[model samples]
Target: MNRITTAIAVLVLSTAAGCGTSRSATGGAREGNGTVTGIITLADEVGPKTGDFCAGLDVRVTPTGAPEEALGNRTVRVSRGRCSYQIANLPSGGEQLAFTVKPSPAWQCGNGATPTLAPEPQALQLKDYQTETRDFRVSCTAPSAETSTSTSTP
Candidate 1:
């Protein structure tokens, strides 16, 4: 009797543990994909200083979410002060998309302080066959760090 009771309890527990709801809070494992595209400006005052805004600039895309399996980090080179980026074939899930822009030492792309992502990471829920648009900006002013006479070369 003891052995039978233990076996029944084990089975019941196992069955209960294995049970899962048919619906997911965020609508689990969906089909289809989505895309995100945008552009970034180097800045009004900084464009001329750099001569070529498209010369030395890069933008990176980072995805933060669960086992998306479709999302990944993407890096793009800015051209003529414009950044057109796209992230496609994404699984239906929650994602915090982030963008960061950096310029080469030769070319300055930020204000007196430093360059930063205009719009921080955004929380978005991607739907099947959906496309989203986001635009970024990079501006600048007189170099702050270089104001001093510290002409130290890296």
Candidate 2:
């Protein structure tokens, strides 16, 4: 009778331990995920482009204080002027990240034009299981004639 009781106690304790471990693992997996979404537009002085002028552009997100191999760094391509990205299972609590829109070589305003991001690289605070929206606009400016001119020496 004594040996049977001891074995039963051991079995109960092991089952309890297994349950606790599984619960913690499941909670950790679901607690700290986040999503970032946005619309990206390309325009000249006139107005925003109507179609996929901004397609193939890259939107990048990187954690502020983490290494290159950190869990939160993400990048997505602009599709029809929209960017949607999600990061699952980041560290618990929240993280600060930098969002940037990388210009595409195909973008052009005019001859010798320069493209620029309206808000520049942005810093955002993201919380666990939260969704954030950040919109971006790309504008282009033609180089001034004087700056565009190449001086000729006779």
Summarize candidate 1's per-residue lDDT along 1-154 as a digit string, tens digits. Answer: 9999999999998888777645333344433366666766656544444344454555444445433333432445455546556655545455454434455445444454455556654556666577777777665545555474565678
Q: What's model 1's overall lDDT?
A: 0.55
Cα RMSD, each candidate = 11.7, 7.7
TM-score, per-candidate, Cα-based: 0.48, 0.56
Clashing pairs in 1: 42-138, 54-80, 110-140
Which digits, one per residue and each the tens of the lDDT, describe model 2 over residues 22-137? 73333444335666667666664523344544455666555665434334435554465444444444443565665556776667665456777778767666676777777777
lDDT of 2: 0.60
Model 1: lowest-lDDT 10 consecutive positions: 66-75
lDDT of the candidates, in the order given:
0.55, 0.60
The candidate maximizing lDDT is 2
